[model samples]
Target: MSRALLIIDVQNDFTEGGALGVDGGAAVAAGVSRLLEAHPDAYDLVVASRDWHDADNDNGGHFAGEQAPDFVATWPEHCVAGTPGAEYHSDLATDAIDIHVQKGQGQPAYSIFEGTTPDGETLSQVLADRGITDIDVVGLATDYCVRASALDAIEHGQHVRVLTDLVAGVADESSASALAELAHAGADVVDSSVVAA
Candidate 1:
């Protein structure tokens, strides 16, 4: 089984001091970087997802609206296209990334595989072309994009393992519940230590 690391949204906007920052997001990046360094050849492919949303888009409005639900409307504007916030966190090992998938180009694409690329190929197709079977997920808010990407990977018939230590969430309870849900879905929820081993 060829393994790949699917790093989800380890962007500046999701880190501390940025809009919609997750708790310990920066730490997640650092941990992921270390994991990648420790297991340089463990993965056949290394991919990263970025939340690249438009500045004046409906997705932005979804969070800014008055009638938006508490969970949905709570976050401030983040990851706007071409902004520094949309860029990957500085701590990540950029040289290790073999593929870069930019999501939320128009709307809020939670799943990295769902978004289309500039070359008209989806992330899943790109991975499929490379014959990637095992996917190790990491980064960003574990309750949202990370969870969505892992589930999507399972749906696409890829064995998924989430590096729990390399992920942070905006809400503790929700993140814990999401991890449980991922486990229930048959995805392995392991830590960086497990990856390092």
Candidate 2:
């Protein structure tokens, strides 16, 4: 099977001391980088997803302003398009990335696959064009974006595997529950080591 690594939302805004900093976000980056180094030939393709929001959009305002009373509402203004927060984390190895998908442009896209390219290409189409059948996902906010992407991958008919060691949740109980939910949805919950094998 042609496998691909889907690195989701490992941006500066999601890391430590950022707007919506998840606990151990930096550690997740380090772990993913190490995994890539250890298994360079295991996966032929690597894709990184980023939250590239527009500063003046509704989704941006909902978070920047106090209008919404959710966990995301309390976050600082981050990941604005072309800004430092929108960029990938420093520790993440970008040289291995074959595709970079930008999400949450005008709307709130929790799933990486939800965003479309300027040419109207969906994330799944991008992978399908590459002949990718198995996808291994790792990244931030397991209960949110990461979970959404994993579910979308499965829906797109790809065998989905979540690299538990290379991911960090939002430091909440829901994160663990989300992982369980994904497993129940037919996703393979494994570590980076297991993925390498």
Candidate 3:
């Protein structure tokens, strides 16, 4: 089976010291890079996603303007397109990524499926065209984007594995819940060490 590595939103806005930074986000970025470096051919394709929201407006009410951010639905201004916050974390090696996806352009998007490549191809189309059947997911915010991406991958008929060690979350409880849910949904929630190169 042709396996693909899905890196979800390992951006500066998600890492430590970012707008919506998570505690271990930087570590996840570094760990993912190390994984890619050690297992250069573990997957046939590598795709990375970023939250490229609009800078001019609220991005379809995604950004909290006057109202205080609830942190669930509406969030603070972050990852604006072309901004440094929208850029990928430096620890993540982008040269290994074959497809770069930009999501949440003008709306709320969590799954990588909601994103599109520079040529405007959807994530599903990219995987389908490349005959990708298996996907190993790794990246930031285990409870949010990473969870959504892996769930979408399963729904799209792709076998998915989550590299737990290579992910960081906003909260411990929610992250644990998300992983349990993914495991129940048929995803293999394992550490990266088990993946064969």
The model with the greatest TM-score is 3
Write candidate 3's Cα lDDT for 1-197 as tens digits: 99999999999999999999999999998999999999997889999999999988898889999999999999999999999999999999998999999999899999999999999999999999999999999997899999999999999999999999998999999999999999999999999997763
RMSD of each: 1.9, 1.9, 0.8
98-194 per-residue lDDT for model 1 (tens digits): 8888887666578888776677689888888999989999998899999899999999999999988788997999999999999999899987676
Candidate 2: tens digits of C-alpha lDDT, residues 6-39: 9999998899988788889999988889888888
Clashes of each: 0, 0, 0
| Count of backbone collisions within predicted model 2 | 0
The whole-model C-alpha lDDT of candidate 2 against the native structure comes to 0.85
Cα distance off (Å), candidate 1, residue 149: 0.6
Q: Candidate 1, which ten residues in sequence have the lowest lDDT sum?
A: 60-69
Q: Candidate 1: which pairs clash?
A: none
Candidate 3's C-alpha lDDT?
A: 0.94
Pairwise TM-score winner, candidates 1 and 3 = 3
lDDT of each structure?
0.85, 0.85, 0.94
